[model samples]
Target: MKASLLKEEFKTNKYDEMLKDLYEDASLVDYQKDRYANALDKFIELYGDENVSIYSAAGRSEISGNHTDHQHGCVLAGSINLDAIGVVARQDDVINVVSDSFNIAPIHLNDLDKKDEEEGTSEGLIRGVVSKLKELGYNIGGFKAFITSDVLVGAGLSSSAAFETIIGTIIDGLYNDMSIDMVTIAKVGQYAENVYFGKPCGLMDQCACAVGGLISIDFKDTEHPVVNHVDVDFSKYDHSLCIVDTKGSHADLTDAYGAIPAEMKDVAHYFGKEFLREVDEKEFFDHLADVRDAVKNDREILRAIHFFKENARVPQIVEALNNDDFDLFKKLIKESGNSSYKFLQNVYADFDYKHQAVSAGLALSEIVLGDHGVSRVHGGGFAGTIQAFVENDFVPEYKKEIEKLFGEGSCHVLKVRKLGGCKVVEE
Candidate 1:
């Protein structure tokens, strides 16, 4: 379809069903209609009124597991309504992206080699995705895209994963007949981030963003993670999902983030294993003293303990959700938060103890929520956002009080979006 025709299609009722399915909030249908039409106009202005495709990839929320996925542990996560959307037109040999948030220079498909200078840049991610696709014997192509994202950056919503998912999704939809499965899309994203973008990240973020819905990912088998869609509705229990941004930059926090997996892996190395998942929980607990002496770091032992407990806790969470046990689910969420704070020790960076936005947010959330809700440090902590499951009745006050401290518009109440990365207007 031409860009102009797609804009017209969005204005009509043709795409309403698809929009509702993607966003999961009927209230946002009109908003999405306008968003798509405006993005189409931008695409027309920049790349002419050519035939184009629309795609959206969701941002994920860490529901049950924290800092456990790096050890190939189990995790419960959900894809939220917030996402990165793109309007793209297939070109010949080069790829160009103009994002509302930043600039990405053109990347030639011929030069997909990892560039040291491109590390940590968008160019690296783009080139890396294409290179991995070709290496895996998947079809590849070039496209110019105008992308926009609502996923909050530095707030632990997996914005970077969403961006990567969308790029791979565009290529999958445009050239490969959308044959790439969500898991492969996620792996491609993680590969780009790890090998090309220079981030030693686990597959949980990308997997959650690409697979969509409330999902439980068991990475014990890293190559073939077991993914199951958890069927439960938060509204049925009179609770709403809330994420409060405490306001801080994740820049320069790479070392803090990397140390987590490195330390956990160190503990695994003590037991002659590559990942913690390969070690038996009983063996780890029984050999605690010897492992502590070998690793020489009590915090790493504590983190290893957290990983085992949290990894076990993920299944209990899935069961609670499946059984509609909201109270038990909330209790497990609270326990997970306490474990992350006490054992995982990621709530605040030790070096910058003075700047403790995440800790502050968690504390304030406890005061406000008190028994009616649950709060925890969200994603690669030590900065950025906190996750809270607030009673629907208390959501307004919770958002208000949190924003008063963190500044207005800092708190976002979101719904779990059903779809992950896919072509938006397939009709």
Candidate 2:
């Protein structure tokens, strides 16, 4: 559809159903309508009014299985209402992208090879996704995209994953008949991040962002992960899902994040396996002494232990939520949090103990929620934010108390979005 027609479509009830499905909040329909309208106008103003399509890829929250995805373990994650949205028009030769912050330079389609200079830049992610799609024998093309996102960056919400998914989705919708599945789109996103964007990331964030809804993912086969949806409306449990950002600096913490999966793999290597998931739990426990000695790091052994327990807990939590057992679900969440804090040991970086903002956030969450709610280290941990399941009635108070320590507007109450990366329609 033309950008002008799409902007007019938003002025009526044309897109209400689609907006409702994506956001799951009736109250947010108008806001999304305005968001799409504003983005369309910007697209027209920047690239002229050509035929364009709208796309949205959700940001994700890790509900269970902290730091477990890299080891081919299971995890439970959800696509949040926060997302990266794009108004894109198909172009013939070169890809150009402009976001609210800055403009990515035009990327020539013929030059899809990984460029060392483009590392860690949006240009790299675009070229990388295109390159991976071509490598996988999928169709590739060019587009001019006006992108925007509400997903808080560096707040453990997987903003980068959302961006990557959006880019892949736009290409899929435009060139590949939208035939690429979400998992493949996710893998493309991960490839872009890992090889092109210069970040070592597991598939969990991209998978969740691309797949949508609350899902349990088993990565025992990294190339072909098993994803299953856990059908339940958590809002009905009378709890609000809140992610409290601690405003902590993630600078110079790549090594800290890298150490976790490396150490877990170290334990796996001792057992002549590549990932801890391949090792039997009983064998690990029986040969603890030898394994510990071989790894030469007690922390590595402890982290491996955490990987096993946390992996098992993902399915248990999924079952609990499926059975409508919110109480048991909450209990399991606390257990996951405890395991991550003690055994996984990613609550705070050892190098900077004095600035333990994540630790402080978790401590404050414990104090505020006490028994009624549950809080845990969110996402990659070591820094950033913490996730909390706060009782609905107490959300205002909970948000106030937590934001008092972090800052006002630091607490974000989010909803699980149903749709992942897809082209929006007006029907």
Candidate 3:
């Protein structure tokens, strides 16, 4: 279908069935229509209503295994309903993307080499994904896309990974056969973020955003992560996954985010290894003093401890979910939150007392939910959002209480989406 036809379909009810299938909620029909209409209009305006494809990539929630993936550890993560969508049409060799808020120039695919000037921008991610795809022997071209997202930017939702996966999905749908697996696409996204975007992040975010569902990923081998899609339904237990965006800024926190992997690697280097996963936990304990002296930072040792323990916790949580043990799962979630606060030390940035929104939110959740829910520091920690699992019946009151502190609509009630990165509608 051309952009014009797609717009017409949206105006009518032709896409209602498709939207129901995509969102799984009949109530979201109007919202979906408005979203798709805006994308279609933007596409028509940018490229003059030629035939185009629509793609969507979801943002992810880290269910467990906080700060463990960077050490080549395990994690249980899921793709949320929040996503980044693109309206794209194949171009000759120039990739032009007009995102919602950023003013990024179009990228020419013929010049896909890394440019220091483009680091830390959305253009870097685009170029890096294309470069990685081409290097991996995949067909690469260009497309003009109008991208928009509802994924909260600095709120631990993996928005950057969502955008990268959207680009990868477009490439998969357009040039190459859409047969490229989600894990490969996720790896490409991670490569782009690590090399091009100048963020030394782990594979968990990209994998979760690309794999979808409630998955337990074992990054024992970073190259070939074992992604197990666990069949755990929160609705069955009257629970909802709620993320509270405390509205904290991630600005000037690169050093804080970068220090996690770097500190873990520092401890690993003391053991003559590259990542903490390679070092035996028993051996780390045996040489605690020596390792502490070598790193000269007690916080690094503490972080390494969190890495080992959190890696071990992933399997336990996976088992609980597999056995339909909601109580155990909740218990483990609380434990993960405690570990992140006590050992991981990521509840709030050090020397930043002015912004302790995460800590305050967690404290408030503990008081409000009591024994009915579980809350934790979400995603890359330091500052941003907190993840909470609340009983469905209590959601309205929970949202009200939290919003009073964090402001209205700061709490997002999200579902675990089944699909990851894919072409949503094609003509």
Could you estimate the TM-score for every candidate? 0.95, 0.96, 0.95
Measured with C-alpha atoms, the lDDT of residue 159 in candidate 3 is 93
Which portions of model 1 miss their true places by more than 4 Å?
none
Which 10-residue window in model 1 sums to the lowest lDDT? 418-427
What is the lDDT of every predicted structure here?
0.91, 0.91, 0.89
Best by TM-score: 2
**Pairs of colliding residues, candidate 1:** none
Residues 1-427, candidate 3, lDDT per residue (tens digit)?
Answer: 7998888888799989887766655778889889989889988877798888899999999999998887889999999888899988888888989998565788887888888987899989999999999999999998888999998888889999999999999999998779899999999999999888988778888988898888999988988999999987756878889999998888888888888888999999988999998999999999999998888999999999999999999999999988999999999999999999999899888968778999999999999998778899998887789999999889898999999999999999987778889889874
Please state the error at residue 259 of candidate 2 in Å.
1.4
The residue-by-residue lDDT of candidate 1 on 1-427, one tens digit each, is 8999989988987889888878877878999999999999988878899888889999999998898887888999999999999999889999989888577899999899999999999999998889999999998988999999999988889999999999999999999888899999999999999999998788998998998999999988888999998977755888888999888777778889889989999999999998999999999999999999999999999999999999999999999989999999999999999999999999988988889999999989999888779999998888899999999899999998999899999999988888889888552
TM-score of candidate 2 against the unseen true structure: 0.96
lDDT of 2 by residue, 260-351 (tens): 98999889988899999999999999999998778789999889999999999999999999999999999999999999999999999999
Candidate 3 TM-score over all chains jointly: 0.95
Candidate 2 ranges beyond 4 A from true positions = none
* RMSD for each of the candidates: 1.7, 1.6, 1.7
Q: Superposing every Cα of model 3 onto the true structure, what RMSD results?
A: 1.7
